[model samples]
Target chain A: MMTLIVLGTLLYSQYRKTTSDKLKGSGNVPYYLIALLAIGMAVGDDSGMTMILPSRGLLIWFDPILEKLIE
Target chain B: MQTLRISSNQIAMLTGCFLSAGMIVSTSKEMVYQAGQDAWTGYFFPMVYGALIIVISIWLYKGREGITLFELNKKLLGGIGGSLLNLVLFWYLLSMLITDLRKLAEFVKTTLLLNTPVSVTMFMILLLTVYLTRGGIEVIARVGHLYFFLLAATIVSLPILLINEFSLANVRPVMANGLEALAKSSFMAVGSYGEVIAMISVMFAFSYQKNPKGLHPMLRGVVFGTFLLTVLSVTLIGTVGTSISARAMYPNLMLVQSIHITDFLDRLDIILVSFWVPSYIIKICLNYYVLTECISSIPSEKQNPKAYTIVLVPLVFMMGHLSFESVVELVHFETHVWSFVTVFLQVVLFSVLIVARLMRDRQRKKEVELT
Candidate 1:
């Protein structure tokens, strides 16, 4: 909860600054979205909800093959 | 918005600290396990590989003043191809950052804060990393310069302080493992040392007063770092012997715990850890800085570096949590998978870029000659 609040505040300020500066290109929407997704996943993981999959499972397939070749 | 620049000496110090800091804690045991008492000999491979990386980096930096590796890729490989390479590099660097964060957090949890949650330790470290990174590379370099001296002083004193514990016979029977086993052990160390290639991303920031010394300063830094690691490997094996050093989780920490100088000077591991934590933080800060630099240069419609840095904090936090389930898994991934990926990027991919640059240079030279 505290992590969300801090990140939310940061994202909001960034959004404000991006708009107030009237940057030439797109706004901070994409960054905000990414941050929100990441924070959600982090919160979920901390809460034992498994919002994100551990990368080890994804990369573990290659380990045995590489280990043999390296050996 | 202002351009940031750091002196060659500063970058050298930063590279030294960046390369040697974490290896002392996490990697020595693996090397000892692989090569037995001949672990110190394994550093020779990384020393050579690291020199090759520095040479190639200097070669790429020539004729391209003030341009970063991302920009150089775009220039040499065109838009789509360059961005693809950048994304690949980004993924690799992100993995590096995640691993470093987890490794440091785990070390702290095991050593100092046994009761503290890994998440809290990681969060605190990332908070510091983000704060230091926001100050830009110059700030990171300055902090590295200060910590580098302290790290060197502490590392240099390890042998002297632990002299009583030394057993010269412990490191004997060195080549009993044969040359093939020694070669295999050296291959693992290459990935750790190849991390010096991270300097390529920030090579644009190096400010040379006269004719640039090419790879001299960086190579010297790497050689010095390798020397320090060699001293550490020798000390760890010499004092603790191969069996204990290999079996211990962090042999360097164990070696430090044995520092009983006249019974008064004990618990030196605490002092060592105090100096070590900052150096590890600097390493993480550099990785974070490079990752952000890569992201900001991805030729996006919205190229906001600061926004990306802010957003990346939570993402890194999340990934750090989701990367590895345990230290054993992390070590396995590092040895088998991460080492190959890093070596491929630094050795194979950079070789491709070097060849492309050479071909382009030849074509330009021929056209000029025709004109």
Candidate 2:
């Protein structure tokens, strides 16, 4: 479920090119939103960090799909 | 008169300092007891993986064009989605900073300043970091350079200190843990080396050479950083047996504590820690820069440090307090979860984007030819 959400955000960022930066929102709510979300992940389940470290062989294979998607 | 500043050399020094980030805390005999005598070899694979990462990063930003990861995130992701991705990236930077602070405070309390609250240590360090972050990237670079000289002076004396304990047999027996240990060690190392991922943010904000060609300096910096990390790992495994090395938090500290040049040279851990502070300073600057840049890059956004830093201070403080556990917990999580996400996101994710972008470009070229 969480992967889906994170993947969605990643995909969306690729297409939208729109970011919620200090210059965007008036209240600075988005700033904290981003900070808390990121730190939360750092402190989140270590096991959940699987999206980053696949086995070496797996990384080599995942390379192709990643290229297609990000491009 | 304009003040003299740090050049690429200084930045390289800072990188050397951080290369030991989890090493000190995680290489403890206890922390790495899982790997037994093979822990040093285990650390070697990660350095190899990290070297690969550095090569790719330099390739991606070939011109020293200063294209930040956040900006690249946008260019690759696009307007709205890219912006949001930057936000997520921003927080990732924050979380790392907090984790570093937590580690520093823990080391201080356990080894020195026994009565000092973690908050006091963290706040003091972070306040210095905040001041440095606002001092501009050049100043950050300059300060890092100065510390590099100091770091060099201290690190060079390692052999002198550990000369008594030197033994070749301790690291004997090639492939002691079998192939599996090598594989797992590489995996653990992937995350450690991945800490260099923090560079993308700073590289982006760096002064451009009109193109990214000068990135060789950064790449060279990474090579130097890895070399130092390799030495630290080997010496650590040497001075302390693999079992003890893995279990001791800040194994390097233990290594330092064990070293004795003269009877008068006993308490040099303080000297090592003093030399260590600059690397943390540069590292803190890097983290804060990433956080600030991510927030500032919000489309149509202008940053006011007062509004941002004020809130950031306490939030970071809270994270430190909340995560006051043994180095083992930190290492367990870092090697497990942190390692996974960092490798996936930094390496796997980028590789994916490059492939996608290239294939798409090729497809478009084909369509143009057909037309």
Candidate 3:
């Protein structure tokens, strides 16, 4: 983790110095989505935490609604 | 900025690699578990469905000519609506990447590195993926193209090698469980094949070529990859018996394990696995590349692909490790939520976008006529 932080810092500094001006200014949502989802999936585990995503939580919330609509 | 270019054949090969990597072990078992011996029949339905969806997706993409999905969404739905849609698509891809990494890590831990930590295996994979992503898409595509023949050879030869073990009785009495069960199982396959939608991210990467090859190689890649997956599932059911194939986590590997070149040359599963590793890593690299492209599209993040790689690769590794307490929960989510996510993102969202695009075009045409 420490290694990554240092590497990230160095790389970002280098990036800022050289090619920062050329950076494209679109596609933020895709990155945000990937970051958010990756974090969500990462924190998921069997700690009985509300992680693991749209699996149990989604099913529990959705199944009843779906069943009601179907009926 | 000069963009790197690859031909249509390379695009097909990359698509084929990404499509087949995750399917080898998991997809067959799920279909067999759901549809029983009729799993093969169930698989056929989705392959067709996915093929049609792929054709439509390509049409939508080609119609726009080099526009990214992110740009298309923004154009079609204004800023916030497009951003929301992009978020949905992002979740779909991220979840898939996590799932694939976890599956691969679990397989490696169980089969190859029993004593090694799964995190280590996953981290190793992410490192390689990051390394490849740093090379940019051209390098990745060329590597995929080179390995495409080897991967194809493996897929084609595996069943032929195991032909002696196959039995008509294993897959006999198909649809004894009724068409309803078969159809239900077919729905599951959409999640697997529907991932062909991920091709959209890189579609713009192919736009500059205007390869006269048309969509033939792309379509061929989709069809051929789906065909390989279908054959793999059916062959596993035939060779391993439906019950065992359904229950076993890695029935395809099990089939390979059963291969015996000679008494002294047994235990060939590991070699088969080594051949599969490149294909699997190619898929991971494609996802990582897409992730990188996504990040680089943001002006602030675009300058240093290296920084993003250094940061996001670790996040991906950690995500795979922490995503589930056990493979069971992961598989459970995969079986249930994954298919819905793929369909919603790939089929439902794309279909709506196509319709909206058509409507907008029609409105423009009507106004032009009035003028």
lDDT against the true structure, each candidate: 0.78, 0.59, 0.69
Give the candidate number with the greatest DockQ. Answer: 1
Task: Estimate, for each residue in B1-371, the C-alpha lDDT of model 1 and write its tens digit.
Answer: 67778888887787788879958777778778888999899989878888887777777777786867877888888877787788778777888888899999999999999999897899899989989998888899899999999898888999999999999999998688988878877877777887776776875544554236555667778888888888888999999999988888888899889999976678878988899999989999999988877776665442645556666777787778777888887777666676677787776679779888998899999999999
Fraction of native Cα contacts reproduced by each candidate: 0.39, 0.06, 0.14
How well does candidate 2 score on lDDT at residue B162? Answer: 86
lDDT of 3 by residue, B1-371 (tens): 66777777787787778777767757777678878888877767777766787667666665565656666776677666666676567556666787888788888887889999887788788778878888888888888988877878877887778778888898888679888778767776677777766666666545446434545566777777877777777777888888888788878888888776677768777877887888888888887777655554344222334446654664566556656678776665565567765776676787778887887789889999999
Name the weakest run of 10 consecutive residues (lDDT summed) in model 3 chain B.
B297-306
Measured over all alpha carbons after superposition, the RMSD of each candidate to the real structure, in angstroms, is 2.8, 9.3, 4.2
* B283 Cα displacement, candidate 1 (Å): 0.7
Off by more than 4 A, model 2: A1-27, A32-71, B1-6, B28-32, B62-64, B207-215, B299-307, B324-326, B359-371
TM-score of chain A of each: 0.41, 0.29, 0.35
lDDT per residue, candidate 1, A1-71, as tens digits? 54674477566656766675632353344455556667667566645433233345435676788778766
Q: What's each prediction's clash count?
A: 0, 54, 1
DockQ of all models, two decimals each:
0.39, 0.06, 0.22
| List of clashing residue pairs for candidate 3 | A24-B299
Models ranked on lDDT: 1, 3, 2
lDDT of 1: 0.78
Error of 3 at B153 (Å): 1.0
Candidate 2 CAPRI-style tier: incorrect
* Distance from true location, Cα of B257 in model 1, Å: 0.6
What TM-score do all the candidates reach, one by one?
Answer: 0.91, 0.76, 0.85
**Which ranges in model 3 have alpha carbons more than 4 Å from their true place?**
A1-71, B207-215, B296-307
lDDT of 2 at B49: 68
Among residues 3 or more apart in sequence or in different chains, the pairs in candidate 1 whose N, CA or C atoms overlap within 3 Å are none
